[model samples]
Target: MKSDMAQEEDEPSGAVLDQPQEISFRRALLDRISPLISSTYTLRPFPSKWQVIRHKLEQLRSYLAAAGDSPSDSQLMELLQSVTYTAAEAQALASRCADESYTGGKLLLRSNLDVVSAKLDFHLKRLEEFYAAGILTLARAIVVSRPPAGASREDMRFYVKDLVSRVKIGDSQLRLRALGALNEALLEDEKYARILSMEVANGVASLVTLLESESRDVQEEAARAVDSVARFDSHKAALVTAGAVAPLIRLLEKPGTSMEAKERAARALKKLTENSDNAWSVSAHGGVPTLLSICSEESGTSELVHAACGVLRSLSGVEEIKRYMVEKGAVVVFVKLAGAREEAAQVQGIELLLRVACDDEQSTAVREGVLRALVRVLDTGSPKAKEMALRAIENLCAASPSVAMLDHLVVSGFLDRALLLLRGGEVCVQEAVLKAVSRLGGMSEVVKKAMGDSGFIPELVRLLEVRSLQVREMAAETLAGMISVHKNRKRFVKEEENLNRLLRLLNPEEKSATKKFLVAALVILTDSTSVRRRIAASGYINHLEKLAETDVTDAKKVIKKLSSANRFRSLLTGIWNS
Candidate 1:
């Protein structure tokens, strides 16, 4: 075999080597450096310096050996050449340091040793740079395989790193395969996701770039991988920081994108934005309008629409983005979704509508379908859906402050649906319906009469004893609003049970704000002399007398009304007896 120096001279300088040639050159260089580091040097500084250089060279050798079949480019070839040259210099220095009788002084020999050590350190750092830069390995066109069953942690780590390397540098076909593998791995074990997250540059960033791939398959696979990784809260910030939002939004806004791709992209976004800090990226990239458009599409797949709505729901938690979505007609889109035949779509629509309902009134002039859709949702939606739907209706009523809207809702049968939910719905749903009923009750005497005639008064009284303090307060307020109508008042007093429930809630021991509304209702009930006598005769009158001393809302007024009626009744009785 030719000597190492002759082999080095035979190779052309600054030329890109084929894979075999590069491998041979690296092997030869490693062979030449090994004996130099292994041989002992007698001098003091030389021994320690060779030890440091030996450690660095050993690390480089292991890196190259393990990085099997990684294709070489000009930059890597140049780095290898520099390492080879530095190894030669180290050998020469080693030979001189071994000769104790040499005329070269200790200072000169030590300085040379220092120079050689520094050069080796620089080369090692460059090797690390190549690794971190994600160009250390350019995978062949062959597909990457997943780790074997029951693989060791280090083995699994190697498999993930190999796949990530392929994703970073492989062709379109290889990248798609690698992304699919990565998605599978991440889903199969969360440990793989944690590993990927640790690879900041070669990992999430490579996947984010694939989001804009010209091929839909590649883009979809990339999005699916991102979706899997994003499922882990620890991985979400990595994805967001890698700039995943803008390209995903592009997929949603892009016209020719497949429904599958859009759904994957939307799902990824939904997971990513679950962290509120990542929400601004969506708004910053015009994602609000794109998401709204997806929701508005009549032909969008249910999954696509649902995922888009989910992202919108997360974005709405950010106040600025919520306003932007409203500006882009998100309310109308969601309102239409609320009316969709699919219960899932209706639920999502109602949820998003609840977020933007206050701003929805601005467009209600053109939204003739909102009330009917909401009423439909209230009728057939799940309990949570019904709660959101009712709350949305209450928001609309409060926003517009219009009697015509309330009349239209009543005409569309809102009152009946609300009463049905109030009587039998879940506690959350009951609270929401009570809010809507309270808003409608305060609107006009006609609404109050309609509500009372629908038998809402008894239900409101029964709710006074519910476990939820908020529900009791809402019920009292609604009953108070309706009690101004004579028929509603009569409906309230017609059941002695109703008066007792109200008075029990108004007891001095009660600490809730519901007493204010109860006092107001009783003050109205004083309009009837018989009702007044019944209230004065109830055992809870002393509770009101104590409440009046504290000056609770309208508590003093209730006391004055009862006291005046009693004085008048006493005088009449005395006159008749005399």
Candidate 2:
């Protein structure tokens, strides 16, 4: 009785103590509201917004943050419940979050609506767990093109700041997601595009910062993003303006940048210099030295060197840029790459040499170092390198910068390297080697001589049996090109052994491409009376008719040329009758 009297005396002045039953309900109610403040934890990182549900979430987050978590639990629960909607009702609330009308009589006392709604948001649908992932995808989609609602460019700017402040990319997938979103946004939205391409290049800047990410995936994404941004004309200027060159150069020094990234970076440099000022910025910023060093790496994959070479070649196309490349002694590295082992290395290095060789225009003198390199690549390089070298040698042979390089290529053992490629390597290498042989057929006096000397006609004909469509077509095309321009090369390759091999390519068992190549080879060899009759003796006419009817065929290279070749029609006549 004394304790009860003390509790009664402890009541607020002039207020009567309520009965225990009434006080118990009040306490229970407060217990429910205690969770209202705790519920705010769910709002962080901002779940992706669906078209309509985003507003409800926004409203919920706004209310929670607006209250500052300082209220009592019971009061909080009351406020939450006062929202006048079930969690389902709220989460399902359409994109029209601004509309607050309700149609229910089961509502709480008019004053208790918010409190009830806040409490209900906690028990949302099972699908809610994937809400963030969904919203992330939607954000990526919508960012490309802005939605027609509440979020504005200004709003996105603020949201971006908030996101950047909060999100820490933890893995490759997340990095991919972020990069994808930014790429879409850059592609679609004028505002975000401007922000990235002009205002600040925000996405590009963010990716650049992530260049240091320990995750290879993140670095890869970052590098790819840089390349993508470089594709946009608007962004290229921004990247250059934002001092992106040095950071990109610095990234190259990191052992982490993949060959793919190096290739892309080289491509980006090409786009970046589409504006001359950017090229000036690159050279002025020590980019020349970096390109030279990257090009000098003769031991690893040559793609890196080729990529670096492509960049220098593209950059130096401008007079000032050419002077920068020359002063940097890029030719020495170009020659070095010709002797490298990796196929891409040789191919790219020769390509770069062609770009800067100044052989096309009569203005500048040739760098013998560069010429020697092309000659070396032509003579000693792998199949791809030799193919590229042939193109470069063609250019060199046409002009001032080491016209002698061509002579060295033909007279030396260079022709043998190509033959080796055809004899043993993969079909693609063979195709490329065949094309190189065609391209240089007119240039290789000794190669023509060697064809006679080495009895190459039989070998050339045998290649018609190559399984790859591309290889067979290339072989046929090579024969036609060689015979069209060089009588010596033609005479040496169309003799007895060669004629029989070419005839078999039109055999019923061969691919349609083989038939097409046979047609081409037959046309080239038809100038000789005996070979012409021998081809007529071969029964291929019925097969050619059947092949012409196929819709899904890949012999487009041959079909288009058939009408133009003088002997193609007669060869068709022979095949049709036989």
Estimate the Cα RMSD of every predicted model relative to the unseen true structure: 8.1, 15.4
Taking the tens digit of each residue's C-alpha lDDT, what string does model 1 give over 1-578?
99864555566754455778777877787678656646533445456666666555554554454345666566777778888888887777767766653457878877877787788778767766776675565434433357777877655665676676566555677677777777888889988998778732246788889889888899889888888888888888888878888999998888888888888899989988888888888888988888888889887899998898888899988777887787788767888888787879888887777667655434565333566777888877877778778777777677776777777777888888888888888988888888878776777777888998788987888888889999989888988899999887777788887887788777777588888888988888887888878877888888888998897757888788888988988899999999
- lDDT winner: 1
Give the top-scoring candidate (TM-score): 1
Q: Please, what are the lDDT tens digits per residue for candidate 2 over residues 267-341?
A: 667678767777777777677887888777644345556556666766776776776676677666766666777
Q: lDDT of all the models against the reference?
A: 0.77, 0.53
TM-score of each: 0.66, 0.48
In candidate 1, position 436 carries an lDDT of: 76
Per-residue lDDT value at 188 in model 2: 57
Model 1 poorest 10 in a row by lDDT = 135-144
Residue pair clashes in candidate 1? none
